[model samples]
Target: MPVSDLTAALADVRALLLAPDDLVRAVAAGRRRGVEPPAAERVEVRPVALRAGPHLQLVSRTGPVVSTVNAPLGERAAAAVDDLLAQPFGNFHVETSSQVLQLRVTKRGEAQVHRSATSRRAVQAGPQAHDRTKQRLVDPDDPLFRVLGAGGDKRRQVDAFVRQLAPLAPRALDAAAGRELRAVDLGCGNAYLTFAAHRWLAGRAGEDGAALRTVGVDVRPDVVERSERLAGEAGLAGLSFAVGSIVDADPFDGAAPDVVLALHACDTATDDALARAVRWGSPVVLAAPCCHRDVQRQIAGARAGDGLGGGRGGAGEPLVRHPILRERFADVLTDALRALVLQVLGYRVEVVEFVDSRHTPRNALLRAVRTGGPRPEHLAELDALRAQWGVEPVLARRLAPQLDAVRALA
Candidate 1:
């Protein structure tokens, strides 16, 4: 066929796919113009199976003949299909490669996916005054609150941690002090971030200019009592401490917390804090997880040699695994998987280093915001990982029941 004929054929195919009504008219017009409909290639409309898992599938008619198409089914896939169905008439793109006709649905139904208007806005307009003040609160020697401040290297570490979290604080609390904010710091060993959070919230400039509440929680009774005494000595009302593991801290039972802070909640404790915050639907959560031993154990267990073929241990290998390698691998896999789990759970999750290793090697922060419903792919991925590892993660197992609960609330 001539180049012109090829272009016309492509246009007709697109029209047929998009507007079936236009197909007869187009065929009639094509016939009038002496243009023959291209011979149908192998039309195989195999059910669009989701190779990754049962999370998504594409349902559409394929081949040369027209057929009734079913609406996309799975919850997440259906949403994607709905978006495709909402598109106005002329938004799809069709590409032909080899003998395969690839249909890319650009729009569906009544929705038009477009770039966000705010994309052009500057992310950092200026050095926020509130952030500067928050940083000063961690400074051990500031005249306004010298005793409340941190010092030297520790002050720098605290400054870095607070600075990372400042940008994420609820915008409404930006400049306002004492808006009756409630915060719970999990595993608050020395209560560094706990104190900083209280200072920031209580000293925040509210609409009426009032302070808020702050609470620090730890598994150690001594730490809890010490924190309470320190709060009292600082003359900070509404600042208190509680002795409880993050796994059991029920902030939702008493008072809902606006913010939940977890700094270096080792091993599965970070997941505990996250699950707690999700249950309470806390507006903001800042968690810096320390060790990731749960997944590490899973990995080690899965890679172990059994009595099967080639499963025999190599000579001089001590017939056992090295602890250091397992620990390091666990650290990486744990954080990565946790971030993915959070994303799947309908929270916008960001994994970033909260501070330098000099301050703390385990400085990774998983900042997440509750948004849309959970993605099925996330759950599927977690399931697949668990199966592959043949070992369940302590954290994942503990919070498995709550996953659906959190999704429902979202």
Candidate 2:
């Protein structure tokens, strides 16, 4: 069929589905050959059953004709309609199964095809597509965009990061001491993530009456000043910036923080942020480590001599097999150890990709939400693992006071 014709037909089908009674009346009228029926002779049209498969069948009975119309569309006719709307223009097969309708489109001139699925009653578009299509008022001349936007590439990356973090904001707020929550962002460089987090939390607050206050901390005085100015321009109240290193700044000294965020904190700075979050007993902590200095140093030292003894091997065998490979391996090992430590300390930890690696090589996000007191065995295992590795986890050392020996045993 012609694309225009198909489009019109799909629209008609959608309209028909939306107003079944009107569809029945139209179908009944179409069946009648223009002869006016007597008042008592007017027939009632009632739908018997509508079934969807490779074809759509609408069974209805009227006066003379027990009519059944078949459209070569799946049972999930509404989903088929959605699929048709999503594409620019193409030949597509729509399959319906209970609540889901799958759409597969084949281009006319190309061998390649595209496929997508939608719930029969899904109201919103998928997260990926929704996020991508969302328009942000980020003009090139805009000072805020100039500082925060790292071109289109970095802006997309920032969006993805914000979307990933968006889901955890509510849970974090729920765990806060009160309806009003506070968050601190360590090493908030350009404050892209910082702003995104604030916006997201603000949206959540609007929806649930959970007010949030956010403070962005960076070592660079100029960046902090710029960030504060940007926040003011954006009209985002309860969000501010400060110039300080994570190690020196006590964000929760006077008032406790509900969440702590440190995205792409360099080397030991990520450790410092995590340590501060733990010490403050912040319910939620999200960090993406940019470098692995501690582990790299350990790997370098190991290369000079032998590996640390533990876990199915002795000190003689090389821990990472090769020097270059060991450095890379240490990065993964470092993040893994951080996650394990978080888990041991009674936090539910998730290690997942926060954004595309092309945007930033440090794409991994460590999402740790404090659940309860640490189990006794968890503490013992943490100690044992630290001993086995012969390297202290900086986060573990900093939050030692909060680490309960009895709870670890329990």
Candidate 3:
């Protein structure tokens, strides 16, 4: 992990410009230039082909928002990267058909290379610019897409949402064969993502070029009707929308869903959606929870009550002594409990920021994929935490019936 190795590792990354061997993804970030690029905390580089010729895209990122431009890949791309290394502010992460590297570059002209090489998931390196809201997955010309306009934010969200699904597709597909793969979007709202998922699925080719079945549910009747109209206009045959509550919505409609998704579903609604997904034992679950009021109220109540029952961290004494800190504490505790519950029920769970926090304060995505039973340690931890807190989450109550089976499975 010496910084001296960064120079050679970067040289190897530069070799990606040689073309015939190709590149996958590359990035140079941090404040190496002394002057930071406008709205760009870092820069990303990728080889792309345009009608004119092969080029490298220089994408500048300031938080979640990004601005990119194309330049000839030969000298320009090489020199740009060289300048970055010369001033090297942050880590350099590079992936190519031939190698995968993580170089921690310091301003002192030193680099710590953790992974200098790995031969895995090689790249075809498409010529055109890649988009999160891929036209292939969310057609702009489609009447529905035209009406929606698919702005940069929407496109980015679509891209981010689909990206998370890529790694689990194989397992999900294995569970879904012969029949079309099924997905259900709880709180489908205007169904922007419902359509995104459908278009995404349409582009997903299986060995049989199989079709996909998807449903979107929202409480608002008008939005459901509007989403349905859009689907009709877009000529998407298997996608549909319905009016229902995430709490009571039987989105599966008697069919077992391969994926259950909820984006920014508010408060306990997210818990409800996730609980239902777990009970169904769905292979994949994605939820971006909003409004931590439920847990916040519980925290306030605990402090107002006897000794804060001091959940898992309760023994740490008063973590929530102030209003602002109380709010943040509740948010973390809520998601932690959610993750532990999923782990207890035989699903691998990860809570991650789904987007740049600058885009929205509520940006966490609780993603889970069923991978068999839970570990005993996870169950014991969850049990002890619950006993200490002396309070239950909305999702915990809903999942109570399965608690015994969950522990037994573990």
Clashes of each: 22, 7, 3
Write one digit per residue (lDDT tens) for candidate 1, span 366-390.
7765544666667777766555445
lDDT per residue for candidate 2 within 1-410, as digits (tens), equals 11234344445435544332222211111111123322221122122233432333344332223555444444454564353343332222222121111111112222111122322232222111222233221222335455454577766666677655643554564565346788899899988878877876775565445678899999899998888888888788889998888888776567668889999998878988888777677887889889888877765565444345643345523656676766677778788778777776777677777777877778888887776777455666676655655566776666666565545456
lDDT tens string, model 3, 1-410? 24466567667656664442356666664433244433344566776777788777778654346788777766776676566555534555565555556565444545556453443332355454354122222333446557556776676666666655544454465567667888899997777777877776655523335678889989999998888887888788889988888777776567778989888888888888999898788998889888889877876666655535654345534677778887887788788888888887888776767667766688788878786765556878777666555557777788887776666665
Candidate 3: misplaced stretches above 4 Å?
1-21, 26-144, 205-208, 307-318, 388-390, 408-410
Evaluated against the true structure, the overall lDDT of model 3 is 0.68
Angstrom error at residue 47, model 1: 54
Q: Worst lDDT window (10 residues) for model 2?
A: 24-33
Residue range with the least summed lDDT across 10 consecutive positions in model 1: 23-32
Ranking by TM-score: 3, 2, 1
Instruction: Please give each candidate's TM-score.
Output: 0.58, 0.63, 0.66
What C-alpha RMSD separates each model from the true structure?
18.9, 18.2, 13.1
Q: What is the lDDT of residue 385 in candidate 2?
A: 58
